[model samples]
Target: EAGVTQFPSHSVIEKGQTVTLRCDPISGHDNLYWYRRVMGKEIKFLLHFVKESKQDESGMPNNRFLAERTGGTYSTLKVQPAELEDSGVYFCASNYGQGRAFFGQGTRLTVV
Candidate 1:
């Protein structure tokens, strides 16, 4: 089974710009979740997608952030008009019935 993969590994953008992060989960896994941990903050859930439907997205910080899962394959997270506080490490995880999950190395987004 293939593990989750994230692109770029690191990103630096100016304030008020946009950034898109991608995540490819293990094949056949129906559970994909997005999480992040900002400086001095614990890892926090951003959203979850089961198949093509978004199971939960209550953890999304604000309207500036958007997440989508098309065709139940891979997912993408976009932050529009990024802010300084948006700087953090974004992780994607996939679950396959087991309590353990596979995580990507994460994409570090820094807004200056």
Candidate 2:
């Protein structure tokens, strides 16, 4: 099966603009996840999905962000009114092993 896929690969936008990132998990895999790293901090978990339902979203930062998995085949993470602090690498990963899995080439978001 194909591995996780992320689009754009990188993005640069001014503050207050909106950006959406996409991720497509491997076929037949029901587990997907999102993660991000800001500046030099350790990468942090953003959310997880199982089929079409979000299994865990405790890692979500705030209301300015939204994540959804339509039909459980692909997922999207939107950051509206992007902030300078939001500049970082966003990663998508998925697999059925119930642990750490394959990761897509992250989308690097730079806010000016």
Candidate 2's C-alpha runs over 4 A off are: 97-100
lDDT of 2 by residue, 1-112 (tens): 6789998799999999999999998887889999999988999999999988989999999988999999999999999989999999999999875756899989999999
Model 2's TM-score against the true structure:
0.95
The alpha-carbon deviation from the true structure for residue 107 of candidate 1, after best TM-score superposition, in angstroms, is: 0.5
Q: Give lDDT: candidate 1, residue 39.
A: 90
Output candidate 1 Cα RMSD: 1.1
* Decoy 1 TM-score against native: 0.95
Global Cα RMSD, each model: 1.1, 1.2
Summarize candidate 1's per-residue lDDT along 20-76 as a digit string, tens digits.
999999888888999999999999999999887899999999999999999999999
TM-scores, each model vs. reference: 0.95, 0.95
Give Cα distance to truth, residue 64, candidate 1, Å: 0.6
- The superposed Cα distance between candidate 2 and the true structure at residue 58, in angstroms, equals 0.6
